[model samples]
Target: MSPGTNVVIALAISSIVIVVISFRNKLVYRQRRELHGCEVPPSLPQLDPVFGLDLILSRFTSLKADRRNVSLLEQFRRHGNTFQSITFGRTTFFTIEPRNLQSVLSTDFLSWGVEPMRLFAFEPFIGKGIMCSDGAFWEHSRALIKPTFARTQIADLHLDDFGVHVERLIDLIPKDGSTFDLQPLFARLALDSSTEFLFGESVQTLAPDLTPSSAESFLEAYDYGQSCVGRRIQLPKFNFLTTDSRFWKSCQTAHEFVDQQIQKALLVTSKQKQDVDGRSRYILAQELLRQTHNLLDIRHQLLNIFLPAHEAIGVAMTNIFFNLARHPRIYTKLRNEILVADLKARTLTFERLKSLKYLQFVINETFRLNPTIGTNTRMALKDTILPTGGGPSGHGTSPILVRKGDSVVFGFYGLHRMPNVFGDDVDVFRPERWEKLRPAHWSYLPFGGGFRVCPGQQLALTEIGYCLVRMVQAFERVENRDPTMEFVEHYKITTESKNGAKVAMVPSHL
Candidate 1:
């Protein structure tokens, strides 16, 4: 035979082998599904199955209309607890079922990883840190930073250090009950306190006169960079399309500020100026410095903690005030609880704050309505089965097949609003419900769960509780100033009100 004829024959054999292997794999998968009683979850209706351009456009439209949460909740309502959709020719699973969440987050954790989220989205912005990495790297990152949030460290940092920032925040509140937005002030407070916590130096954004030019620039760049990161995460598969020169510039500015802080810590370490052995003072950057001197590692780890620390606390405070303003009765009740407790006479330590049941309830209700990190996505590292969220009707009572490389997206916002768990009045903001509410495990994850649960949970709760108590103590009642009493979402890495929490406060002395 001629050379060309021989080549054609070889190509035909390769094609035959490929087809045979594909068929065999399908057969094996089918047999496994049958054996395990796995079924495909219901598919979301999509106009374009190949690229899912329609789904993407619809999402962008919902976001622009400020109804992202509404749209997402509607999907779970229509498709039940679990469903599948095609995005860029890849099958993505969506679930709000607590059992499935338990499986993905804990029981079957090893079969999933956050590699896609890290590589496609966060690494470019935050670098590879604990929140961004998976597997061994994530484990190492967690171990290195966990000590900084130890009970001893958090308690030591609270009270004296936290009170200063709270005083500044209160001083800014209007005395005349004039309408004002608390969201911006909350952001400033969070940035100030978070910097102090992480770097042992506060940016002091709340104190304009004391703020430096570099600090102002850092705040600007950091805010812009985080906003951009939020958008990139929204479309992680298309991050390249979202990022631009401005985004890169912002990331660089934020990096420079962090790098400067790292240098200061390094200088202190080199001179033996910091009493590392005594554990007298705890700074996240210094703690990281003790672990490794790698500038990038330290910067990334600090940024990772700072991002959540800043955003979560700020967002939580803003939402808490948002609800408190609209729900005057609840606010009054909460305030009465605080006053009756006489926390002023006693030092408000970490344990003391945790004992305030009503305050805890209010915080819990706020988190349920608007979790800081609303929706999260994870990728399957291997073929696995979700505990439920399958079958013909998709009632979420049958095991579902999850293939390798599939993306599983869970909406905590929806999970928190489950009628069966939270009652038919899930839409209402009633902190009293938490009095007897016992949501199943994995159902209420304001700070997330499993091995990757937030290391900063205790610190976050403490800061939020301290701020809430101080605000309530100073203000007799909160009045909603916005025309609408409803909560609108301004979602990013976290969700806050689109319409700033506009409200007036009645001074307690009056």
Candidate 2:
């Protein structure tokens, strides 16, 4: 054959190969769908369907408007409990259905992995540990950290140690009842408490007289890194284009701080030369060292644990106070309950805090309205079927085929707002609803569900409860000071009020 003819033949072969490879996954999916009686969920109508450029642009727009969660909830409202959309050309499944979430997070949990985008986004600051790893590594990380939060450790709230920080928090409040933002104070309190709990010493960001320049730098760096990581998670694939020198510096500073703590803990351990039972002491750094003496590994694990604990505790407290300030009647009721019980700071144990039924209701309602981690995504590791989101109507109760590599996005915010599960007044902040409300399984995942459920859940709730009871005890009344009564979202690694918990307190003595 002539050279031209040979070239044409090669081009034809290449075309055939491309077509076969592209259709192979679809053919497999179709076979599975037919065999299992699965159907595709409704797809979001997109002008740029192939690349989903329209969806991508709209996401950015929603983000800029500071309504990303609202925009997502609206999509569910229009589509149904479960729907499909092309996000930046990737096939994505969005679901607020309990059944589907149950499968993804628990029943068939192994079939899904941590969304790679999240790992990519978080690894720079947190490195590879529980929060950013999957498979055996995640399992190992979980196993390593589990003992640190064992029942014995978590129950020992060390009220005396924590009370000191709460006292500092209360002192910072204006005595004359001037308006103040509680968000930052909450953040500092969380950081100080978490550091002391995990590192064997507090950074003491809340104590200006005690905090050194290095401590302040560490706090600022961690905060900056967290903000950067939050942005990076949104567009992980293109993070290179967005990341800057400052983010790198912040990561370095945060790492150095953790490294210093690791060294101190190691030195203490060596001097004592005792097999420290981390579960007995509830110190994360010491526990991590017991697992592995590798300095970098310990640093990564510490930061990973710190990120969620700090963000979750801080943001939850802020939202709780935000709601409390606006709802004076509920606040009064909560105070009465605490006062009636005659609980003191010294007596605030894990069991006693849990016994505060109304306080638990308020916390539940706040989390239902504003989950700290609003939306989470998981990547399908193998072809599987979700129990719902199928059939011709798109909302039909049939299994939906989820192909390997597809992304599953579940929104706790939307799930918590389901009319059927949470009632018609889903938007209203009503603590009384929890009195008789029992949401469907997997529908009320404030701390998530399944094997990967936050190990820090108990500790976080205890911390929030401890501080909340203290605040209520210290003040006669909490008054909303912000002109805007609505809770506007300020998204970071976690979500908090954009306008913050701006309020004034009437000191009980006054």
Candidate 3:
């Protein structure tokens, strides 16, 4: 053939290929839409592409400004519970509807996985431990550590340690008619108690005469690194191309301390197996070390547990106390319940502590109002359908389609406080809400839901309850010194007060 003829033939082939690719793209889009019992959820406010992007930016800017994360709650209220928002041309969603959450977290759980962003963000500080891990690694970590949180073990931990730190916490409070920030004090108590539970020795972060102070120790480094993980996530991807030197320094310092502990523990465990019987005992680190010989694995497990155990419990305690201070009637009611319970019981057992109906109700109300976990997120591993929340596009009950790459955030703030779910008084701080109301399935997930629910929840609840009981016993009154204090949470993996929980604790008048 002549060169001209060949050039014409090449143009024809290129056009055909281009047409085929376009057709294929359209086909894939249609297939994804039809997946998981229905097409993808409609954009918030049920808008088209251009309008949806604008809506997305409004929400994004609010978040970027560190304002409310559930900025779409209004949209959800107006339009529907499940809705999508586009960011950088990528679709993400929020599911506040109960059935949708149940599907995502429980029923169809295997269809989704932990969001990659969470893994990437947290792995540096905590490694591939349970909290950020998924699939096989998650299963292994969960299984290995599950037995360590046995009823008796956790009860023993609270019985022996949590009370001591609670006493320290009470002592640390200023009685000079002056206010003090309770966040750091609670953190010290939590750290000391958690360390004692985990490593068989309290770091004694609340100790009176520590020359250097706990703030100057490994706890400081650990806190810095944990918060840095949040910072790193917000930074642009490939941010390490110009990584923060301070972050690395904090990571190094934190890791070095944890590693030292691991090595020391290994040495001690090797020579001394303190098992009275041949069956072995369940101490957090020693038991896990006995199971897995990998130091890094143990470190990650230790850090994952230690960081949340201290930070989350501390945050929860502070917020609870903060709320209680503002509501003295509830505080007095709770204190009365504690005194009543203590008087009636022959001895305070785990069951007895847990059985304080009004006390448990107070804690429940605290969790409902301001969850420390704040939000839970998951990424779809495959095209899937949520069980409900499909009416946005006039496709009621047809099931919302979720594309493989889509992410969903379950915001507890709105979920727990929604009037439809919790009644008209949802926004009010009422411990009595739980008295008459039985929360629907996914509506109450303070510790999360499904197989991946926090294994340490019982332990954490016990610790909180343990502290509160001691606190009520020690003090006749709890009041917020800073009445101007409002609920503003700063987020890492968990949310905490921006400054601190400022409150006044008065000694028992009797």
Candidate 4:
């Protein structure tokens, strides 16, 4: 009796265990399939297999040395646009064609949203400012802040102030042959321009006696914030412990510096209000802080305004100078334009500066060739179809289902350089392309697109333009110290050149 009963009980227990294990396995399989939109082709190879994990790891490690965007563009050419892969711990949807880019940015923008790290990485410093916020919060921030950018003050103040700073920079440069790294010079110019326009204070970053290392703490902290954000994408659990992280330490230093400046600005604005002609130029920061008492919110908006303004202008200026030194004809034409304008006034006024069409052309040309933000990222809010039709890669109109939570990377660098849109001279630094740009709403987005387009575009353009005009007027000859030097791209929020551009400047007789 005991033997028969024992054998039957053991068999029943084993059967139950087998059934439970099978059920658990099925659920796990379903979840993974759902994550990839369930429609991912079975034949589509894993990203690691195509681009070996070792190589991908190496690329990220040597980010400072590699021309990553250019290399990725080359890979897109070889693999074709619309390739599927995973890198930095998320699935990536890369496209180089205009049609595909338009579909992602304009036609089906609502389907995509910002990934977690992309939005929250700067939370320790910026909070949920417009740059990081999505949905309603983003809308509210946009409403409150966009008007400030739209104000005539932004246009008038920025151009005039930037021109003054550029003149100061020129006066400082030695008249005789002296070689210097123009990269840091441009960086300083950008930082000063942005700071003056945003906070009504000048750091005099471009002064000849001013050392770039003075702001090294702030720049390092800024870089740390970007790295932390990128790292968050791969390590979600790290968020809970970020305060103890080195990244957080760097962020704290940046926040403390900003807070001091903000407090100082507030005090000055208060004093200014006491005067009869009482006018405060720190309107952007003042208004933003007054509307929201949240410290993180204030920090976020401040950094949002500061970081992009610094990075985009810095990179664009570097590229412009690089291109000008490389192409003598373009440089000469640009200088001639500045010379003609200088004849009208000792100092270029904001209104007079706008008439320099060639300067604008050169800036636009640099943007096309070297976009500051190499890639645009968005997450799927719900399972939706991408409007992109099949390319040469045969990813046809089968309604590409994007599962909720998957990240879709709209490749801006790839799109900007696409042959179909920009033509055969795609890689060339030709400002003339913009003359024929015509109105292609979503196709060309250096400042991003849709509701999220940069509100600071006008300010950025003004700052860059003023600096360029002043530089041209000041220098009789600008020569590239390292014409053969290649720009190596590294990702830390905005793309930065690994080694700065070195150039020689000589004062003009005019």
Candidate 5:
């Protein structure tokens, strides 16, 4: 044999030996960490067909609901609560487990962060707002808005703007008995209220005789911009070839609408101080400017609050109304609950509203079945560990190893509907279940959990609950135009009825 050929063979053998030794060293280090309790348990069991055409196909297959979420639920049902996978070229860890949830979202929150992809996708509209940005920016943003979202401020809005919108909504309803998709009506109602609550000037979406309908374009822009953000996240981030001109157009429209509002608020604020109407119903922009004069910063924060607050609140009301339409029995039961409270008060206040237990149960039930923002997807900022699904040695109580750059997605619908946490009839909507089934905080996240929990949670609940109670108070009957309920495909922004929820209203003799 030639000396050159022998040298090449020798080099190949040496390379193989080096690889083997490196592998052995890594295995030994992992074992040492596990024994010393310095690290989480071994890696978790990965879900099959992890990231490829098959996974994508399964996700898009079900047109009945958010196919991606439906796919996640199917996997959880098959492979315990915590399962690891590779999705869109990134290592992803998904969990519906209570303990793991507490770790990822609360206890070890510093270890995990909001997926950067989300920040980039939403940056066009929300900018460096609290929802997408983290660290000092998130802290600063949270601090500035915290005071404005106080209970007293929320109560004032509920009592004033919210009540006004619902009254206009009643007038808009046709007594001619024709069924209309109530989702748009609810959106219009929510938009009108959110405008006054956030901007200090009602957009007058209801087109009342005294006011003109002016916000139609603004609402359209907001919806398109948000939905595009959802779509962008679903697409592969590394793919340079991908582009959406339409999404940018929507962004322009939304930015123009919001920017105009911000300028108007600034012009007004410059002239005179806003009246402190006891509860402080100052426009959010004015309150925001008190902390910073940066128009860009103000624009982002205001947009962040406006878009999701508008879309999510609207969807919540629509779904609750849709569900109530199907279950007239729940309507009557809730109305009775409201009437009993009615005798004790001249008008309902936030405190009085909180006292209505059954109303809360209904609200809880609605949020459980349809969490508007279903998944809480986060990324690992550093090498970390999840609390469970670490396989045999500890009966899955062992911690699961998570690598930096990996994603942790908390599917709310899957978690909330888990049989172990919520009981056997998890899929069924039973308001009474709130009576018997009480799960851990992380397990029952409707507006997320821990430090990153939704800031507008109280405000959203007040509006949704207050609207429903007042709705049932004014009208006796909520009849479904269709016998069955159907859900639209998920846009990642929020869910809606596939076909608008058609319903008929009948007055109850007051």
Candidate 6:
């Protein structure tokens, strides 16, 4: 009885183990097949390091200068528009040509969807925010928010509010002849402006008695969000488990702050009746809550607006200010234009600011040199062929087959700096180029292009323009304290100045 029972039990256990192992092997094989179908081109001459899995895992999360990324464009210059490789995880098709960009963004936008891995990384913090979401959800969110910025008349209101914020910033500038870090100051200003505009209340981030704890928490959350994305991309298996870990604790802090502010805005909006002019100026949170009774939808929309609204504006402003500090001539030109415009009206108004062509040029130039959103990625939702012109620099006429699920990275930095698009002096800070040549729309996409272009671009431009104008108007002379300030191009979300911009501001004579 013992021998028969023992033999039966042993055989059953072995059979179960075999089935499980076979199933596991099948899953792995399927995944490998899906990956290989993406059809990444053979490694280019320069892709010696990217081919190694160990090297990618080690250096993927590293913030050091990626010569590999940089060289993709250089290879394009030497070889043409299309280059190929598998980096990080998926097969990639990189394009710098305007025609290709237009095709990807405009003509066949649906075919090239947001990259799964990138979206997976971003989902933790931003959730399905309009920036990350696609398809119907994106359409719904965009429809709801589009009207807020669609009116031509709101331009004046935008500028006027921006001026008030700028005045607050000017007051905060130190007159002690002591050098101060402008990065934090610009960051605060951008944050304050975004909060005020989005929620109808200011965090007073730029105030003299800035609340250090709140600022630190905000920054910590932002950095945490950025790091979480990078970490998720590198380690997919541990994503959900690690999302709530200490690395993302600061994200919780940020969420709490955002929720509190949104709640406060809702309360205020609830109390107010539609004004005689139909202008009930309340926080976007309040406006959104009033319109939608659905709790889950409300939460999603709030998160969507808060994440991108706060950081995108901040990053854009930081880049613009960094450029202004580095190129004083551009600053001087911008200031003179503002001063002349301001004097003619006896006061600075939003309408008047639009006439300052040089200001627009400066903003455009900043975008060209240092885009706030540097990289865009897409996943092939279906088997598609991306038409390739040639190798990195080659003019070969060939259409590259991009299988479904392949990841495609559109290098905004590489495309913006392309000599064919921007001319040979692409690296130089020349606002005059905007006057001389009109760039193809996709070539200079700081706010991105096509179906998912940033909804807040107008507001961002207004806020940035106001800040630049006021800073230039208030300071007679501004000089960079750190002339050797290096650009930190490879941060998780934002490109930051490695050394915070230190500047000396001399008061202007009226």
Pick the TM-score winner: 2
Candidate 1 on 1-510: residue-level lDDT in tens?
999999999999999999999899779888988999989889988889978999999988988887777788899988898899998767898899888888888989999888666655667667888877888988888888998786565654445667788888898889898999999889888888888878877878777368688877887887777767777776847656454888888888888999998887776644222433444657778878888878898988988888898887888999999888888899989989999988772367678888999999999999998888778888998998888988767685779877788889999989999999999999899999998998877899999888788888888888888889988998998899999888888766677788888999889983
In candidate 1, which residue ranges exceed 4 Å CA deviation? 1-24, 236-243, 269-279
For all candidates, what are the clash counts?
0, 0, 0, 2, 0, 7
Ten contiguous residues minimizing lDDT sum, candidate 5: 38-47
RMSD of 5: 4.3
Better candidate by lDDT, 2 or 5: 2
> What is the per-residue lDDT of model 3 for residues 272-341, given as tens digits with 9 covering 90 to 100?
3433344333457777787889888888898888877786589888888888988899999999888876
What candidate 5 gets wrong by more than 4 Å, as runs, is: 1-53, 62-65, 151-153, 209-214, 238-242, 270-279, 343-346, 392-395, 486-489
Error of 3 at 407 (Å): 1.5
Name the 10 consecutive residues with the lowest summed lDDT in model 4: 271-280
Candidate 4 lDDT by residue in tens digits, 1-510? 699999999999999999899798657655754564444421224456533465456555555455657766866766666666655434556665556566566677777666354655657655677777677877777887787777765565445456767777667666667777777667767767766666657667666676555366776776677766655543444444466577777777788767766776667636223213443344466777667776556666778778777887888888888778767788888888777655432345555566777777788777777788887677777666565533335344333555566666666787777777778888877876666675365667789876778888877776777677767877777787875655666576777665566678877787
The residue-by-residue lDDT of candidate 2 on 90-160, one tens digit each, is 68999988888999889999999884757878888889999878888898788888887765545454556
Maximum-lDDT candidate = 2
Clashing pairs in 3: none
What's the ranking of the predictions by lDDT, best on top?
2, 1, 5, 3, 4, 6
Clashing pairs in 1: none
Compute the lDDT of residue 261 as modeled in candidate 2: 86
* TM-score of candidate 2 against the unseen true structure: 0.95
- Cand. 2 Cα-lDDT: 0.85
As for lDDT, the candidate ahead, 5 or 6, is: 5
- Pick by TM-score: 1 or 2, better one: 2
Ranking by TM-score: 2, 1, 3, 5, 6, 4
TM-score of 6: 0.83
User: What TM-score would every model get versus the actual structure?
Assistant: 0.93, 0.95, 0.88, 0.82, 0.87, 0.83
Candidate 5, residues 291-318, lDDT tens digits: the string is 8998888878888788678866788888
